[model samples]
Target: MGGVYVLGGDWLPDAGNRKVLTELPPQLAEARVCGLMQTRRREWDGAVVRDVLSERDARLVLTIPLSTQERRDSLYWMAEKRGRFTVRSCYRELVGEYEGDGWMGWTKRLLANAEALRNRWVECSRICPLCDEEEETSVHVFFTCRVAQRCWAKVRVEFAGDVRQSIQTAFQYMFSVMDADRLGFALIVCWSLWQCRNGAVWRGEAVTED
Candidate 1:
């Protein structure tokens, strides 16, 4: 894929042109003739510059020293210190930065939201929004509810043992048996079911099977 050229600071929109920096603005173009355009911000003071460009982009720019010598531009990996690309480096680049505390954090959030912990604190109804026939416990919302069961039934995978246990155990068992792609599809179904439940509760919409 062709690499993207990101201009720093707030310049005028390039009208979809990537070479906007090469064709500098009239003010900057004139300044470039006087060597003033090459001036670095005093506030930066040898520190990394920040603004429109990302941290990676800023670091990449710094690596290219200002030189009078003209040379053919070449692309290099920005993730690695030596600008060499590797499978691991590419994988890390694709994944980007880690956010939250992974599955454990997600489980806690799911429990808190499904169990209506906030509602309990305020002395409100803890009824399941989708079914309205039982308390909105984590297990009911994620596994046992009529809507949740329908979502799970749509998946092609079969459970060897009982998956009616807690959410964590159920997921653990499911993950152990399924491949990565299958697990991902199952997770998407779970998320979609949750979204549908929220829609029913907040917007009075009917649960959709598809």
Candidate 2:
């Protein structure tokens, strides 16, 4: 409990050391996520949180006021029972995935990267069901999964952006540079990626078509 406190991330400012969070390895990322969950559990183990997430994000996370009901949200998402994306949760963060109004659908879809399942502490393969090669992180589902790669390939989008970055940052960079029309089209492809991922994971459907 050695940090500042706030409630929710709607008004939270950006991290000062975002590179640290982005550069952390997947295993350490899980640790950072667990540290955030300490807040939800009404236990702010500030040492572990700051040690893992660096000072800036830890302070940003600590700002959120704990609730008696144990709410579920993230300060910055890991692949599983981690914090939600705090710095950038809006679809506009992905460079205007929505125009006049924001995309509530896409915001919720942020938590559905594993085709509607997210592991907590259980030791299981985090492998992508569609690819069977990489972890089923949101980045993988949308940009780097084998099926996802094919979908991007169909549209002649060969680059998968940067898999090392969080899905939000990667999407922002990938979409923001495109023209308005391409950006709109990319949003559709993004939604298709989600739908096809669900179809393949939940319905036992083949998903090679773009």
Candidate 3:
């Protein structure tokens, strides 16, 4: 038997695609299908890069298919079987409000406006707008930005512990950062910093965290 790939199902539209289409109209579904096709072809990076889902990807990620509880559990197991990222943390922040049995999240809202961000990245002809640091990309948006580093420093000072500098390490630090309220506040601040980075890139607006 060949490898079981998510995009390798019969060309005939399946319930999955139909569900996805309902959430994201034809144009996005086509783009998603293209991205998934690249994945089927063993192009992991291409698949992820090709994904233009942005905010929609965040929104669609949470929508569970209607089925028996057991099947739903299995589906979740497969969907979440990959390595976790900061994006998931952002998603969790939006889960209670936007996640109504669907994958809607703050990141998804940001992604919905990805084209603007992409345009700013290319045409706006600016360095990292947040701090005028380096070029804006996943690396700069999440880490390596001076403004972001400052926020992290605040967390480090408050925690009064050896705060790891790596983005992954900061996530672990979030676990022990005090009460639930403060932890959530920290997470939202991180998310806001990322969103502000995009706002600067896309809208050419420069504002600092006060």
Candidate 4:
């Protein structure tokens, strides 16, 4: 309602934009964006935009990528590499706790952390890209690495050194019997660790934010 989207605009508005739009006349403000382009141009009609929006908002539409080739619109989920929603990514976004999804798969040590992949004769370094300090074993990625430590620290949860030490020998057993609240927090953090690891490995994007 803050005038971010038009019925059929060529421009996609920034999701966070909430600016009030009083400049545009009702017909133009509510108008479909079908013919906003100049009569023979791929670019927006600058005067029309500048007349209806502040200079800043007008620039958004002005900078839109236009093409002469015909192409269909598509949708993708930004949260995942495949751009498709899955139970795992969806659960993480909605509940922050992956419930019983691959967050537990981290405990089973099944996903392709670098060390496990290298062990299968795959030609890759076993180093943790996030920490660059240790081999990316399930234990190292989830607990011992500096990056993992910072994630727990951000959540204001501290693990006794023994938590990682003991998990090396009995991780599954520990998770099975841990306090429910603690287990939930642990899994959530593990989900973050997995995401960071994948981003670092696959996309060269190391997520440092908490």
Candidate 5:
């Protein structure tokens, strides 16, 4: 019952008496044929046909092309470049890739800055340059700093209750709720804050609310 299915040919049995055929009717099998049949049917009937065809399992069947020449079937690994599995491809398949766009670059820089401060790779005050209230860390500098809170307040974003302990969690929350424009504004604020921190530390400049 399961060989490569040909859409327009002997796919369906010619039984006019049956209301529901086990196999897809030839009229419903081909996209062109289905479109024509839909136009001839009532609007409700067409809608029902569309709904059935749109189901995940039914749509998968539609992707199989009718064979012209008989060729031996062979299995292939889709994750690999040339349908051949390799150690590198397997690793990549398991780990995946970083697909985040927009604010990710700035976020990474902010994280690096925090790490630099932690490792004492950069000679600056251990306290947050913006707040001067707590030890400078990724979470403290970006999320919990009193001065950072003020900047967020200006944007009217609430960062209270069960405080996020990591940069990943904070970014996830922001991205889920804020659209591109809002996310851009938030990133700009963070960048400006980082710049102000740099100026304060390097040039011994005074920090201002503005």
Candidate 6:
């Protein structure tokens, strides 16, 4: 106990080995000790520090020195490299007003372009064939189109009874209650609506709720 050197300031001891008060609390005392080793220009492997603490706890602190932005970028890079880019990229492609011939492509466009959606309404010849006019877009066809509203009325006559029809804010209206498969189904529903619209336009076919 005679050689014990207590510290009060943040600075580490110099090569001459004078005691510095670190003023660190118990939880931080261990970290300050480590900082001292690092500051003295001492050569200590990171593994040596890990070996001194529990594995989980040490790993948590190992990456602590990184700045906030650095940590975010590292996490994003890891996720992108792991193939999680579909949701955002798909959303952007939709916003760009892209159109496609199949389920994947059409759905992407429908979600993005209001005009393309109206065209489906027109094609169904069940009503109007325009992605514009608010009547043909995804929100309308699913929840508010006169035809669609009627369909839902059958299921819930009181549905939106006195409420005005409203557009969905895509970002705010995510189906969090659904499981992964159901979530996928929601995406598929968007795709199918686009396909139905296209069939109405090119085929001059009549559309049905089914």
Candidate with the larger TM-score of 5 and 6: 5
Where model 2 places Cα greater than 4 Å from the true spot, the runs are 1-109, 115-125, 158-164
- TM-score for model 6? 0.31
RMSD of 6: 22.0
Model 6: lDDT of residue 69: 29
lDDT of 4 by residue, 7-78 (tens): 433234443332323356666666544445676666678887677667777776676656676555444454
> Stretches of candidate 6 above 4 Å error?
1-134, 146-171, 175-177
The TM-score, computed over Cα atoms with residue i paired to residue i, of candidate 3 is: 0.35
State in Å the error of residue 89, model 1.
Answer: 18
lDDT of each: 0.52, 0.54, 0.45, 0.60, 0.54, 0.41
What stretches of model 4 exceed 4 Å from their correct place? Answer: 1-109, 160-163, 166-170
Per-residue alpha-carbon lDDT of model 1 for 96-139, expressed as tens digits? 33347644544554434545566457554678877778888777
Candidate 5 per-residue lDDT over residues 131-158, each given as its tens digit = 7778887777666788888888898766
Task: Select the stronger candidate by TM-score from 4 and 6.
Answer: 4
lDDT of 3 by residue, 1-210 (tens): 012222322222222231232244455433433343333333333334335334433244324222222221121212233423344454354322344533324234443223446755734543666776566554355555777767767666344444545444555566545567666666666666755765565555576845
Report each candidate's C-alpha RMSD, comma-separated, in the order given: 12.9, 15.9, 15.7, 13.0, 22.0, 22.0
lDDT of 6 by residue, 1-210 (tens): 112222432122231222242244576554533442243433333675465545543443354342322122222211234535345443342333334542344344344334453466633323444333453455665555555444444444222232324333432243334444444444444444544555556555467765
Q: Where is model 1 poorest over a 10-residue stretch in terms of lDDT?
A: 10-19
Q: In candidate 4, how many clashes are counted? A: 0
Task: Give the clashing residue pairs of candidate 1, or none.
Answer: none
Task: Give the Cα-based TM-score of candidate 1 against the true structure.
Answer: 0.45
